[model samples]
Target: MLKLRKLNAYYGTSHIIHDLDLDVRKGEIFCILGRNGVGKTTLLRSLLGIDTRTRGSIELDGVDISEAPTYKRAQFGIGYVPQGREIVPGLNVLENILLGCNARSDGRRDVPPLVWTLFPFLKEHLTRRGTNLSGGQQQQLAIARALATDPRVLVLDEPTEGIQPNVVADIEKAIVSLNRDHGLTVILVEQKIRFARTAAQRFVILEKGRVAAAGAAAELSNELVRKHMSL
Candidate 1:
């Protein structure tokens, strides 16, 4: 569903991602794994047009989106839940989710039933200020907001980062359900090796802004993990 070829990204004058190539098939969870500073987040940002500059090709569902603006890309069915879960601090939970409706072609603003199904807690607290929620709750709210976009491809950057352990499992299950049951195409940048192994069909390990090793998830052996990911 998504492909990148010879992609390079820069922040200001300093390049971060170098000649990177990747592919994510429809209805599959494609995980990106790497140590810090390997351009994992940069890659996601480039795909969404958030980086300072980018070169080469970015295609989604066979359509080239390399030159599209960020909003246009979102309207093209790319829902991004950025690494920090950048929920608006002032908006209520419901309002925050509704923000994603800006990308909807149908012009509807109601929260999708799927969000309520994935996170029942959010439905009950629609009036609560988004910033008042716990980190994990905030993360769920972030995902809910993205789901409100009615996207064909969900781009998640570290959905489980800095959450409580119990909530991490909940987030993981939600991600799995989104991909396995709902058939949403996913491009995930994840640090949790166990979840990546269990949930992803394929993965790419990045090193110094380029792909070092990539293959079926089952092939992400312990030795490979130690060599590339262990700090």
Candidate 2:
């Protein structure tokens, strides 16, 4: 389980996350929702130790990791898939996935068989350049790469963004499969109401870097959520 308590983070001199708190249990999908620029991505970065948290504690299975560096935190089984699907364009699909292995070389990833089973297209396009794949395929590669690390907790920033509806469905299906099959903890950062509504059990809504509301999906009132979520 991953827990954040009163997390205070700053980007340069500007404080972005304000006393944010959240918890993600194992085998569950925890969704963070809000409009753009509400510091959703920043929160994920903070959890991954990309930014210096000014105060509070981030704990993974009761171990404090707020002060741990990014690489060290990664070594503790935290995998991140950033918003842009940052796969190396010049590298082949296999090589791109290999980048997830925390290795210093190419075609040398110890990728799990289940990962390729989840994303069979990756195996088929192993030699294709990362840039040549379609948007959905690239997204799949990014996710598959993250799984290569064999993380206990996977934090994804907007998995459904910039892809076709069919692809989004596929990604959602994959997330569900990951949780059900491996008990992988998933923290999903999303702006799409439909994605949160359908995929998450609990929801956390941020407005201007603060948690404006939080509750189980069934308890949330749709009309009010839509009001705060309007762009």
Candidate 3:
């Protein structure tokens, strides 16, 4: 559902991603794996039009969105849960989620039934300040906020980072359910190799701002992991 060709991304003149080309198929969990400082997050930001300097083609469902503004891209069906789960601290849970509805064409603000289904606790704490929640709860809120956009493709950057172990499983299951049961296309930048192997249908290992190894998840062999991802 998403394709990038010869994509290059930069941050204020410091080049990061270099001629990166990738494809994320519909209804599939596409995992991007790499050690720190390898441009994984830059790639996701570039896709969302958050990076100020980018070149080449970014297409979603056959239409080019390379030059679209960030809000326009979101309106075109790209929902982003950024690396830090950047929820507004001052907003209550409900208000934070409602921010995503700005991307919808109808501009409707009602919380979708799916959000409550995925995060039952959020329904009970709609009035609570977003910054008051636990880390995992905050992450769940972030995902719910993104889902509020009704996106065709979800871009998640390190969704499991710093999450509690027990809550991590819940997040993982929700991601799988979103893809398998709901048919949402997922592009996940993940550090947990075990979860990546189990949840992703295909994987790409990034090295020095470009893809070094990529294939069916089963083919992400130990040797490749050691060579490209090991500390």
Question: Per-model C-alpha lDDT, please?
Answer: 0.94, 0.85, 0.94
Off by more than 4 A, model 1: none
Stretches of candidate 2 exceeding 4 Å from the true structure: 51-53, 103-108
1-231, model 1: which lDDT tens digit per residue? Answer: 898999999999988889988999999999999999899999998988995599999999899999999999999999999988998988999999999999888899899999999999999999999999999999999999999899999999999999999999899999999999999999999998999999999999999999999999999999999999999
User: Cα lDDT for residue 119, model 2?
Assistant: 93
Q: Estimated TM-score per prediction?
A: 0.99, 0.94, 0.98
C-alpha positional error of residue 111 in candidate 1 after TM-score superposition, expressed in Å: 0.7
Report the C-alpha lDDT of model 3 over 57-122, residue by residue, as the tens digit: 999999999999999999999999998899897999999999999998778888889999999999
Candidate 2 per-residue lDDT over residues 85-191, each given as its tens digit:
99896999888887788821233458779878899988988999998988888899999888887788899999888998888888989998898777898999987
Backbone clashes for every candidate come to 0, 0, 0
Higher-scoring candidate on TM-score, 1 or 2: 1
Question: Model 2 lDDT vs. the true structure?
Answer: 0.85
State how far residue 220 of model 1 sits from its true place (Å): 0.5
TM for candidate 3 is 0.98
Candidate 2 lands at a TM-score of 0.94
